[model samples]
Target: MSSNAALLFQGGIGVIGLVAMLLFGIPVLLVGPGLWPSILLGALGASLTYAALLLLTRVPGLFPENLERQMQGLYDFASSYSPVVLILLSLLAGVGEELLFRGAIQGWLMANTDPVTAVLAASVLFGLVHYVSFTYFLVATGLGLILGAAYVLSESLVLVMVWHALYDMIALYCLLRFPRWFGVRIVDPVTNRPHE
Candidate 1:
């Protein structure tokens, strides 16, 4: 499918996912307002997963060059945007992407199948829906796995939403403020060395 067409399709799916999540998640949230701990744990879990992935990419013999460039580009773009712009971007991403991938898709999977199957299936779908370059796909899939696990652990969409927003905001800040510290150069994923 054309990129535009694919995006539109994904957008539609996202809307559906949001609605479903709100329907089921709200009740859970209302019943157990004290599930904040789970939510916090979920956020921590996601952060660890992301860090691990970054470290893995730095490991020798496992990195992909194209993937590294893509990551660097993403960091550069986020770093370039103003704080207000980044906030807006994060809000939109948290609402749209989270709703579609974690809320709607994950909700459906949890209802129809076991949690393990649901998480794996939803993560795959989330990854496939991007239809971007391979590196982008891998990053997104890794993110999906982290987010999916968060949802399951917390059983609260709100926690994942907040975590997602916070994560994006921090990434944007890091990209903008400490670009060099974060390794601005694109590294070859396979060799874990800077790409020349």
Candidate 2:
């Protein structure tokens, strides 16, 4: 398939995932808008995540080689798409993942377990889903911790969703627009040469 077609297909999958999350389980009310803490905590969490990633990228050897390669591959793929498509995918991921992981899984666990246990449990599962490599898993797990804490402390699912989405957007932007700063060398998949 053409690159643009591939991106559109991926976007379709994201939309379907979101719709399934909404239709299959999550209550409409759970994702509903809330007050100040929601927006505040969301932006705070996303900004913190972006800052951490930027710093980590600058510090060579901070991330495992395999992890770096995996992340570079992801960024390369993302950069192939238009900004609008990337944003939609990011939004879908934010909504779908937050609804399932935080709203459904963590929320349910919190009822039966301690807050710490609930967060950890949910975070572990969250990490497992992104199991590309050990390093990627750990990074995702750490993100889950931050997102979970934000959700628990603020009691706002919407907030975490926004955090997750904005965090993704920032990451995508950096990876696509500033690969050199992050030490990423995007290569053509077929030719295995540096992408111009």
List the pairs of residues colliding in candidate 1: 17-104, 63-189, 63-190, 64-189, 64-190
Q: Write the per-residue lDDT of candidate 2 for residues 1-196, one digit (tens) a residue.
A: 4556655654564465456555655432243346566777677879888998777766767777555577677876787677888887788778777877887777767877888998999999999988888888888999999888878877778898889999988889877888876557877789989977
**For model 1, how does the per-residue alpha-carbon lDDT over 1-196 read when each residue is reduced to its tens digit?**
4434434554665577657777766222211224576456546754765567657766765645455466577775665555666676665665567777776776677777888887888888878876467766777777788778867775667767766766766666656665554467855779989765
Q: What local distance difference test score does each model get?
A: 0.65, 0.77
Q: Please list the residue runs of candidate 2 whose C-alpha ends up more than 4 Å from where it truly belongs after superposition.
A: 1-33, 187-196
Measured over all alpha carbons after superposition, the RMSD of each candidate to the real structure, in angstroms, is 6.8, 4.1
lDDT at 64, model 2:
70
How many residue pairs of model 2 clash at the backbone? 0
lDDT, residue 54, candidate 2:
71
